[model samples]
Target: MPGSLEPLDLGVQIPYHFRCPISLELMRDPVTVSTGQTYDRPSIESWVATGNTTCPVTRAPLSDFTLIPNHTLRRLIQDWCVANRSFGVERIPTPKQPADPTHIRHLLTQSASNSNPYPTRLSALRRLRGLARDLDKNRSTISSQNSREILVQLVFADTGSESSELTHEALALLVLFPLPESDCAAVASNPDRVAYLAQLVQHSSMEVRVNSAALIENVLAGSRTAELRAEISNVDEIHQGVVSILRNPIAYPRALKIGIKALFALCLVKQTRNKAVSAGAPETLINTLADFEKCDSERALATIELLCRVPDGCTAFAAHALTVPLLVKTILKISDRATEYAAGALLSLCSASEKSQNDAVAAGVLTQLLLLVQSDCTDRAKRKAQLLLKLLRDSWPEDSVGNSDDFVCSELVVPF
Candidate 1:
């Protein structure tokens, strides 16, 4: 027995037509899509679940979103599984079919109906969430059937009540599943949505706030008009909500990321930048950097660089002690892109105020700049670092440009 030959790793090959087009796995519960192509149930449902309205194999637009079960094919697949059992292939279990559209429609009507029982509404919401979770085809059905309005309505109702449970589920679905452009535009038209979302940021739980921020980001990204976003971020409450999330020590990393991205989007307006600085974005940014991993620091620095272009931005960033040193650390260390931001931020500070220039020099920014210019950073970073270096040398003539505690640069030929 010890000298017996071992079996090779080669396994049985299944028929090409029997394999799912998307996942290339044996189709356990094969289903025919609107495009008339067959795919495994979960795989096809997932394709539609991602908000796509097309068939994976056919690449044809799905005018019909319904999925038709292939009972005959499934039986054949089962027979194959049984035949291949000796080859170590197990039978693929039958997957439960998604709820019928009529059932989903009835639940939607009941949930949106004014006189529906609260318990019934909760049950319908749970069932709707389940339907949404099961199939991408269902998302198309929901969106096309006007149930997106109901989902949005539920998210809008996410008050600090028992109904918040429903809202949380609804919010996840809206963000995870892509909303129709019309749906996003419809929500954007509602002027109160901004303040409404901000209230959640202030008073809601961390999950709700994150969902709200993501929704806002999504809505903003889907818009066609600058006027829409300008009006959205101009409100003090909305601006503060975004900054508060940035400064929120306990906010999840995703919340912080979306919040900063939202803030960046809002700061495109000159009026909003002043509001962001007034809302204490600079200090919060400094605190964020102290604990941020490399990725977060790049985001924070990019925001700082953007804000630093204005006079008030320079004032706010210069007032913070970690602003200069942090910029120095991020340069030539985190990433070339971050180094570019760091250099741009330094240039803004030194350009706006003489005191900031001297402070940057004292923070070993000069040596960092020399290293940054010599390092394999972007052309923009090298140029900004060189400009800031010249400005520092001209302003503080006696202060050695390279002879700092961080590094000596007497022999370092910094290209002027």
Candidate 2:
């Protein structure tokens, strides 16, 4: 009835039963209520959500508004649409079975109890994964079951085999969902779980690795309790996994950003800086910054700023041959913020010894500072650079240092 024959374009006529009583459109996710009438799930849900007690069709005082799935009718409707594809009717997909808390608990229990190899356990994990990913209700359903411990056990369980196909699947489910904070904490709870993530960061597919790093970073940012924060920080492998991301040359830019954020978060706690340094964080971050071939300078610089906070962190930076040079190179070449952070790192690293001070001068930092004082850098950066310039000028070997006018603060290329 809605189509126009004169224009020679007539849409297929939809059946009345296929139409929702409230919305007057083809039913998607159709459900039957107590009044024996079917309607689209969203419309009925909205009607009930608004506190209406009576059924739309019957106006009856429906004591029970349970939305029973109209599966048989849904199947027939899908079949009809498929049969009439030539009429421009698109087949509806088989809707995912509605989430059941009972079923989720049962699957989790089975997942825990089964001692069989991965095939049997994988089946339940796959089902649980599907339900968790398909809808928010399912995610809430699984979360309410307090499934984190179960998931962690499955994920970190020692399979003893080389191929971790099932572990990877479970990891994917854990990382790819909007899970509860408590659930995410379980991933960082113990050394074994943290080790699993570190291993994944090294060997798993890019998606899984990225998600793993991100999950660690997220937990760092928003873990619920103080004890949980301490627990997460104590795991050394979490730091290793984050460092590995920056160390990986083939990682994508977004993954690299997430990795840098993890470092930033991890570096906030004083106790964790030693773990980061032990994880080769300084070297990995230096390489990441120097990888002009494919790098994110903004986050790289910010992470370096955080890493330099620890004394051992500074020692690590100074030990790396390229660390000072890379920080100097980033000045004025990348963003102004990078320039500020680069200046900050130099201040932290070279401010102590006469030899390190001279090394900063040799690294073209003096020239960069002169330019920074005059360039469009941030005010904070300009002030710091000027202070460093004064420090270097005072510390310059006056006898052999050609002339005060030679270091006369002209704009130079900064020796990137």
Per-residue lDDT tens digits of candidate 2, residues 1-416? 11212112445567778778998777767899998889888899889989999999999988797889999888877876777677666777777756778898887776667566657677877888888878876886777776766666666778343427677676766665455676667655665665655666666576667767776777677677666666766677778777877766565766667778777777777666789888998888887675633235776776677778778788888888887778887789878888888898888777755666767777877667766776777877876676677667766656634644333444432321
What is the lDDT for 76 in model 1?
Answer: 85
Stretches off by above 4 angstroms in model 1 are 1-103, 130-141, 153-172, 177-190, 249-253, 290-297, 374-377, 395-416
Model 1 Cα shift for residue 78 (angstroms): 13
Q: Quick one: RMSD of model 2?
A: 9.4
Per-residue lDDT, model 2, residue 53, is: 95
Give the distance in Å from residue 46's predicted Cα in candidate 2 to where it truly belongs.
16
lDDT of 1 by residue, 44-64 (tens): 878887998887877889988
Q: Tell me the lDDT of model 2 at 180.
A: 64
TM-score of 1: 0.69
Number of the top TM-score candidate: 1
